[model samples]
Target: MSELRTLYPVIEPYETGWLDVGDGHSIYYERVGTPGGTPAVFLHGGPGAGISENHRRQFDPARYDLTLFDQRGCGRSTPHAGLEANTTWHLVADIERLREKFGHEQWLVFGGSWGSTLALAYAETHPKRVSALILRGIYTVTRAEIDWYYRFGVSEMFPDKWERFLAPLKTPAERADPVRAYRALLTGTDETARLEAAKAWTIWEGETITLLPNPELTAPYHDGHYALAFARVENHYFYHDAWMEDGQLLRDAHKLAGIPGVIVHGRYDMPCPAKYAWALHKAWPDADFHLIEGAGHAYTEPGILDQLIRATDRFAG
Candidate 1:
């Protein structure tokens, strides 16, 4: 059997800066890898998770020019965790602005999890601007997807973690609808309540993303500052359904026709069911699809990461 792939050696960004994306939001962005190589953009998940150093290692630094940025309210973006004017469309526009700023006519778009959702939105909205696509852990943000993670599906699989997730919400109604419940606390006036709820919300995702418990992955979710932005921005987006119409991404799959693409998904992905990834593969038949065994939702999983790096390397040509 072939050896599993892993991240490229850690490399620092050659250039980094902040973009004033308006609506009182200043986005933090960085450029890495060869300047004149294949142009590509990396979209981080969580709609709130922001970018991390590991994200820069996914592509071959010698072959691809990559741009990664923190969306509206998360990471180093100003007004930390602010929700105003932040939506799926706002982010899509921000991507375009960055693309224009870089002067790339079109670039490969690579995203995983929620990043997959944004990539689809952006690519569909401006198909002419995408040279290729590489998506992983496919998520369309439909009601079923949201309910699976926050309400019923994953809850049944991880009852112990589910219990901890529910401990923050006291009422039957809140437990019944945790997304809205968390949103209320996250956006409410009570700072203490907000931070507490944030930890619960963030921890739930951190612990559950991997098939196995990974302290290194889950530890950051517990930090009060990180959790607040993660939970608040994530909840805000979820509560609003990412401002996307039902089944919008899938329905627009036709827009992806003729684009070079790859889909990498874990068979046992919890936050994002494998079914949706299968659905996307069916919708975009031209794209190569890999259903990895012994993996979960996180891009860091061995099988998933191997497939992801393979996809990027393949597209780097």
Candidate 2:
């Protein structure tokens, strides 16, 4: 963990705008760093979680031209907490649109957690448009991975938190199918019920993301609007398995064979776990893999942060 390198200095974007991707949806994106430097796009986690200033610090401003955006219904994008016309494929198309609009033939793709899932989906579908992939906290959205975090596996590890996560669901059937139950609550007509479910769901996610609990990080979910979007959008995608076939990313690994990649994962990741990263590396051995010893799923963890920044620096050339 001590071996991790320092991130490049904090820098602000010289250009920021909302790109109209059609369907009455616009994604907010920004361009930072050198005007003609190496082009890279930062994919944020959570189907609903938007970009942050911390996300921008990962790249060296002098060497890499960086792009960051809030997908669909989250962050600075208009029409908060919207679920309509938003899907995994929609986001992939948004990426292509951003790339073409930027006039870049290919860009270094950087993502973590759900962002990694999107990156792989985009790269595999349009392999020629990706110069390289730098992924952290790798998640392929496999049903087994979902079952592990939302259903059985992560619960066993955090029994106390798991119990709270299940408190909102009553009846054995709801317990048996928490995702379905939560989706019902999240999308239900009752405003209070939806907000309560959102808080609980978001808190559980916040608690398990790191080795030690961070209440401050999960505090934003208390906002009804943020909670609604984060939980609703996340569960919406998870409900359909992000519209992905089982093991789809790994099954399509051959499509990414020629593209260079760097897979970085925290050893103790609870939400997505490290095995997904391992599985990705197994199928695409050409990419370098790092299993940080003292880290959890959160990209902000010292070890994971170090590795992620290191990867961006490595690919900045």
Candidate 3:
């Protein structure tokens, strides 16, 4: 499979310090390219993590002004995963803060996986402020979505992996109570439990994202400090019904229906299935959807990443 794209020289990169959001929480971010270009904000996946250097390649820097940052408690962000100021609501607010800070009344929003969900939520909440969307690997964060990941999503190919993931839960009740199991592993002082949970969580996430048998080059963002924060915060939202009623997006698609969006989904993506994308496109019929055959959930997939970057560049241009 094709590897990741090399960072473009035209995409000038610069790091900014931090933005304090109170409660001892701060977010880190960086900007690239000329400010006068089309504004595009890159939202990296992982609720716990921040933007990656590779994320910069999503858009050709020369065409679009790029702004990428770690959310609160993510990479480069201060007070890693500080629970006091972490939530979907907090993240949405942070995006708004970035836009106001950069003086972009409207900008393109790009996201994948959980990032796609966040970008969609933000656009829905502030449709007038967003120019368009370039989303990949859409994840809905519903119980069905999580259930698909844990049980139905990749169990056939990764049965052993799933077994290990669910090994900690002895009974059906405990398995059903994934929230409790996840909470204990994250917050409990049990080192063995935490480590086991971390390994299981990371393995499932990593394995599901790719099928390439290869030398592991990049670190799974899920294994970092942001992973913990993302899991906890994501679980909080998932437990609370993702704060979206069944028809939340469908009910609100009209706000974003006329807005332009180029959506990319992998045919074999197990982490977040193609079904999610199909459903989303049905909700917003005008959005463009490109189904990449033979590709899975991993952004590193050979043709998928470059094609997505190309789409971003086109939009930015």
Best by TM-score: 1
TM-score for each model: 0.99, 0.96, 0.89
TM-score of 2: 0.96
lDDT, candidate 3, at 145? 76
Which residue pairs clash within candidate 2? Answer: none
**What residue runs in model 3 are displaced by over 4 Å at the alpha carbon?**
1-12, 170-172, 214-218, 221-227
lDDT of 2 by residue, 1-317 (tens): 25767667778999999999988898899999998999999999888888888789999999999999999999899777788889999999999999999999999999999999999999999999999999999999988988998889999999998999999998899999888999999999999888889888887887888886666666675677777788989999999999999999999999998898899899999988787799999998779998989888988788888878878888887
For model 1 the TM-score comes to 0.99
Q: Give the total clashing residue pairs for model 2.
A: 0
Tens digit of per-residue lDDT, candidate 3, span 139-192: 877667777776565777788877877886678976776656776676678866
Query: Which parts of model 1 are misplaced by more than 4 Å?
Result: none
Query: Which tens-of-lDDT digit does each residue in 197-229 have in candidate 1?
Result: 999999999988998888888888999999999
Every candidate's lDDT = 0.94, 0.89, 0.74
- Residue pairs that clash (backbone atoms under 3 angstroms), model 3: 2-302, 48-226, 73-81
Q: If candidate 3 were superposed on the true structure by all CA atoms, what would the RMSD be?
A: 2.9
Question: On TM-score, who's better, 2 or 3?
Answer: 2
Q: Which ten residues in a row have the lowest lDDT in candidate 3?
A: 213-222
